[model samples]
Target: MTSPLYGQMMEVPLLASSLLSHASRHFGDIEIVSRRIEGDIHRYTYRDCEKRAKQLAQALIALGVEQGERIGTLAWNGYRHLECYYGVPGMGAVCHTINPRLFPDQIAFIIDHANDSYVFFDMTFWQLVENIAPLCPNVKGWIALGDEGCMAQFRADMSVPVQSYETLIGAQDGDFEWPELDERQAPILCYTSGTTGNPKGALYSHRSTVLHAYAAALPDAMSASSSDAILPVVPMFHVNAWGIPHAAPLAGAKLVLPGKDLDGKSLYDLMEAEGVTFSAGVPTVWLGLLSYMKSEGVRFSTLKRTVIGGSACPPAMLRMFEDEYGVDVIHAWGMTEMSPLGPLARLNHRQKQRPLEDQRRSLEKQGHTLFGVDMKVVGEDGRDLPWDGKSFGNLHVRGHCVIDRYFRREELPLVDGWFPTGDVATIDADGFMQITDRSKDVIKSGGEWISSIDLENIAVSHPQVAEAVCIACAHPKWTERPLIVAVLKPGATVTREELLAHFQGKVAKWWIPDDVVFATELPHTATGKLQKVRLREAYRDYVLPGAVESDA
Candidate 1:
């Protein structure tokens, strides 16, 4: 063993507050715009946001709030919510962003589990706050975010004293300074959507967040810069909106947060009005936007690229965005356990010059790993698989930003040193990775694995099918085979046979779903990913027609 002398250098902790401070000092005049809950456009500058964040920190301190305490927020993507992202953490407290779409019981469970001292929520969730308040008796108080006049009724409903966000921060003079805490202190707490059991928490540190911001703002990531206007269709409450809120401010990009209105027209209007060049969100959000554009015969004047994650981006949607709208669709993959970003699609110069279809195919993959992350796929025997782009296995990753252990859980969630992502994936020789299917969701037909996402994407490519979910069903010969539950477009009709025939040449004949069931709609999670768990349960007993199919 060799003992080495450490290099003498200036040392400074990487703090979340410093990102805001940088913006305040260098890009103080850049606009941070939002469509407020009050149904009006609100505009502010980095200077104004920094001051308000300091005021919020001061107000929390005056309430006897101690460092390391948890503060909960059930708000949408807005300016005040943005303040909480910087403020609570800047004061050495953890900002716990709760997804409001969670059930009232889950909401209560999270608040109680985190031992939240106070909760700040948007007025849009007034009824949710009222219902969960009685259940979370440990919480110190409730505060509603909105105009004071719109909040009087909500204040009367809480058991604890409630105050409007304006009034609470208004009492402070923005005099507090950001505390210098350990770089390892958690600045954010986010829980996974409880699909299987009680949700688990992924606590993010000050250091990981700062590094994630730096990675996300890179040209290959979101391509955020001073010249670009970014509207994060992804909510701030979810994985810190895939790190855009922090990255945008870090790069001096103009931020346009789409509050509660994520419907197609609202997003189009906001994007056009703000001259938004880059936007990001899950595939479902972009689906709504594309549908609206095609229907209204409208086109984006300023938007250039969209980052789609949460689930695989359907090839059909990507084609529509590129062919019709001249917009680039970058597919991304990550999880709550990761600082929520892992691989993102960024083509090198040579890949960019390929034919558009060839380029689109590469972009459809989850993408290449960037700095701060590393990945490998392992088979059931726990052996590393070849990166041949054909064989797939369980995906595992480890890096600076990935979670080592979840909040409050003693069990180590890692296999060896890497975190198992619960996804079955294949990495090509070129270093691009593609998620074939979730480990639980992958369908095994005749003992051969099939990607449900591939099947579903082919199903939705049919003009008549609006949406689809591929699930493994009980079969007669093969233990479990793929079946697609499809939703048809409004006023559009297609036979079950027609939908099945659409996949003829696109995929292997055996990978084709045995049957298709048309329906009115599909189920999705709070953050808009499809709810395969509930759908699987709903079709658990479903039977295949005819005398036992043997196509596989």
Candidate 2:
């Protein structure tokens, strides 16, 4: 007989709603910590957060905000943002997250496109609010998510009615019921990063969000628990901070907020002050923290686990945290469409006997797909490749949480019930998946596909390199060539010849970078992933040997 499916699909109560009641029921005293702009730390319990969410919901309704209307927030990862995550949705309204790092035009477009009726913003986004308010004519009011004393600095706004978030919460009732949801109805709408084209909204339904959150808190995913003092350094505007806010509360994890300031110093201070045990953010955020620790002679005394996603975590960065800092860095991989849950690097019991170095090397792969997620690799012929690690193919995924289509832009390209992730990868016999390249980032040299990711990883492993970027440049003999950009560590120097020599014995000599360009820093995406497109555009006109210079 076929093995029965192990995972169960059950209708649990609304996570936030249940958690608040539970906090009041059992864990009422657990603290939710946040460092606010008032220069004082704010501490509350889940019971308080639940009551405040209800109050916010009541306040929104009293303000003539109706269910199904869009509510937008331009704030940081904090307690207030967490309130909006539940309050708006519980009241049957959709929460649209606007990326603060997006260009002014894009931000305006997303707000207008979502038809947001009200905006909750942070004090730091005052100038951004002023510039974009006129463009978003549908927004009837703006609430600054600040304490009473800190609201004065943000009161100088334009045409919209500016209100204090504290005042609204203080004046409302905290006894509203969350309407029963269709589960398929849109609850959250987040836009794609728009690196290639116009940003399209990936609207998530209540069911998808809830399912993804369940997966996120699983043993292999985030493995969050009530004991985990979780700090999501990822921005709330980006894929629901990789769904951490939703999952953490569902698991009753104590929430720690770093607020609007995410610099290394501020983050480290919060982690230490809050006694955060588990955290999740991109590699760049942790990279800064690692550098800060090195410079200031600090260490992560309280932090025990970290989740690195939004981009591939360099093995060196992972090693630093796991080996040196004594914090486990779980390499995660996902995208906006997957509700950001695809794979996680959880070492099984079998791998525990391996050497630390070997374990680290295995963890660098994206790890096994979660229970609800199913993954496959497809070659150019659209045939599924074996999960044998040796075969590199385009990665395709289909699952419960994976988005079926884009909002307002149906006809999304789909094949055989799977969504093309645009990622190239290799799957080992044991089910560990390693991303080789982005479909667009792969370089074709002399009709052979070269993974720039592999090339850059090798280059950065050199002692002198601090950062690296690999892009395809014009080649006279090969049509397209791989160009490596290297950023040196402080007080370190190496020429192109010296770096190429280091990689000579490791990779094929022909696969080595033909020309190495040194730089002070590498540009990164809003989510902290290396922006290879920017690197390509920045050096588009580079002249290569025996090649003509042409703008890419």
Predictions in order: lDDT: 0.90, 0.83
* Model 1 alpha-carbon drift over 4 Å, by segment: 1-4, 156-160, 547-552
**Any idea how many clashes model 2 has?**
1
Q: What lDDT is obtained when candidate 1 is compared to the true structure?
A: 0.90
- TM-score top scorer: 1
Which lDDT tens digits does candidate 2 get at residues 87-122? 888777888988989888888998998899999998
lDDT of 1 by residue, 1-552 (tens): 433676666679999999999999999999999999888999999999999999999999989888899999999999999999999999999999999998899989989888899999998898888789899988888888875898776667655567788988999999778889999999999999888788899999999999999999888888889999999999988889999989998999999999999999999999999999999998888888888988999999999998999988888888889889999888899999888998998898888899988887888898988789999999999999999989899999999999999888999989999999999999987789999999999999888999999998898889877789999998878778888999888888689988888999999998988788876778999888999998899999888764155544
Number of backbone collisions per candidate, in order?
0, 1
Please give each candidate's TM-score: 0.97, 0.94
lDDT score, candidate 1, position 166 = 92
Q: Which 10-residue window in model 2 sums to the lowest lDDT?
A: 11-20
